[model samples]
Target: MLGNAEILQAMEQLQDKLFQIAVRVLRKDRTRIQVSYEDHLRIFRLLQEGHKETAAQAMEAHLEFGKRILIH
Candidate 1:
């Protein structure tokens, strides 16, 4: 298991990556893509509102697969 400091560092790095992905997903390949600190805050606010639902859906899908039985 990662130590607390290591986990915090990892989380910070992950946040940076997520911000980049969010920017790309929110503004796909346009001529200008500006993420001011204020804009970043707004994007984070939007994500905070819906991330739980997205995570819950993914967990449900994963659990459903685990619960299924396959026979050959």
Candidate 2:
């Protein structure tokens, strides 16, 4: 079992990794056009508001679609 700080740290590390992946997968001329921090927070808040399945799937699909567009 991890302490609270350890758990938070792990989550932050995972978040950083995801952000990097998104950046690399969606960067346009070194500009990050992928999901931003604000967008992530909005998604979190929406999930907290009980938007479990649809919003998440939609956001992921939207992100992947953008990645396809920007990466190509």
Candidate 3:
């Protein structure tokens, strides 16, 4: 319901590795999970409202935040 087939395929390709990392990291820090979940919810709502640009920005912020947290 959210993305096209190509987007879904791309996300699917990364799902396994992402899930592994998420499990390892989130197990150690519950707050990170809550933050990421909130990020997703924000993006989902923006997309549902047809605010593609804002949703993209929200997704960008989410990824950037995740990258910072995941990186050493």
Best-fitting candidate, measured by TM-score?
3
Q: Candidate 2: which stretches are off by over 4 Å?
A: 1-19, 25-35
**C-alpha RMSD values across all candidates:** 11.7, 4.6, 5.1
Better of 2 and 3 by lDDT: 3
TM-score per candidate, in order?
0.36, 0.46, 0.69
Pick the winner on TM-score between candidates 2 and 3. Answer: 3
TM-score result, candidate 2? 0.46
Give lDDT per model, in order.
Answer: 0.53, 0.70, 0.82
Instruction: Tell me the spans in candidate 3 whose CA falls farther than 4 Å from its real position.
Output: 1-13
Quote the positional error of residue 55 for candidate 1 in Å.
7.6
lDDT of 3 by residue, 1-72 (tens): 385998888888799888887776676567888888898999999999999999999999877766666675
Cα distance off (Å), candidate 2, residue 42: 2.1
Q: lDDT winner between 1 and 2, please give it.
A: 2
Per-residue lDDT of candidate 2, residues 1-72 (tens digit): 367898899899999987787667655544434345556677788888998886688688757765676567
The per-candidate count of clashes, in order, stands at: 0, 0, 0
